[model samples]
Target: MIIGKVIGNVWATRKEESLNGMKLMVVRRLDTESGCEQESFVAVDCVGAGIGERVLVTTGSSARMALDNPNKPVDATIVGIIDEVEVRAEG
Candidate 1:
C-alpha cells in the first residue's frame, strides 16, 4: 500500500458501467519519512476519505481485489483513511 493525501475529487458523468457508483478522488503520494509530496493521481475511493485527509492507497491488481471486481479498470484505490502516522528514524 502507498501512503498519500487526498488533494481533490474527480467527477466523470460518463464512465465504465462497472464504475457507475464508485467515488473517485485525486491523491498525491507522500514520503512518510520526510513529509514531502509527490505526483498526484486519480484513485477510486473505497473508504469515505475527503480532501486534505491522509489515506492508504492500493494499486495494480490488488486495487481490483479491494473492490471485489478484477475487471473494473481501476489501477488505484483508496482503502483506508489514516488518522495518524508514526515514523521511527533509523539509528
Candidate 2:
C-alpha cells in the first residue's frame, strides 16, 4: 500500500461501463522517508475519502479487488483513510 493525500476529485460523466458509479480522486504520494508530498495521480476512492485527507492506496490487481470488480480497469484504489503515520529511522 502507498500513503497519499487526497488532492482533488475527478468527475467524468462519460466513462467505461465498468467504471460507472466510481468516485475517483486525485492523490499525491508522500515520501516514505520525509513524509513530503510527491507526484499526484488519479485513483478510485472506495472509502469516501475527501480532499486534504491522508489515505491508503492500493495498486495493480489488488486495486481492482478492493472494489470487488476484478474486471474493472482500475490501476489504483483508495482502500483506507489514514488517521496518522509514524515511521522510524533504520537502526
Candidate 3:
C-alpha cells in the first residue's frame, strides 16, 4: 500500500473493456515523515475519493482485487480514502 494525495482526474474516451465504468484519478505519492512528493501515477478510484484528499493506493495485482475483478487491466487502484495518517521515524 502507498500513502498519497489525489491531485486530479483522468478521463479517457477509449480504454480497456474492463475499465469501462471506472473513475481514474491522479495520485502523487507522499513521504509520511518528510512530507515530500514522490512519483505520480493514475489510479482507478472506486471509493469516491476526491481531489486534494489523502488516499491509500494499492498497486499491481492487488489493484485488481480492489476492483473485485481478477482480470481487470488496472495497475493501480485507490483502496481507501485515508482519514488520517501518523508515522514514527527512528534515526
Please provide TM-scores, in order, for all candidate models, with all chains considered together. 0.92, 0.90, 0.91
lDDT of 1 by residue, 1-91 (tens): 9999999988998888898999899999999889899999999999889899999999998899888677889999999999888876772
Question: lDDT of model 3 at residue 9?
Answer: 89
Q: Per-residue lDDT for 64 in model 3? A: 88
The superposed Cα distance between candidate 3 and the true structure at residue 22, in angstroms, equals 0.3
lDDT of each: 0.92, 0.90, 0.90
For model 1, where is the 10-residue window of minimal lDDT? 82-91
Candidate 3 overall Cα lDDT vs. reference?
0.90
Model 2 regions lying over 4 Å from their true place: none
Q: After superposition, how far is residue 43 of candidate 3 from its true place, in Å?
A: 0.5
Model 3 ranges off by over 4 Å = 89-91
lDDT of 2 by residue, 14-65 (tens): 8898989889899999986688788999999999899999999999888888
Q: In order, what is each prediction's RMSD in angstroms?
A: 1.2, 1.3, 1.4
**Measured by TM-score, how close is model 2 to the native structure?**
0.90
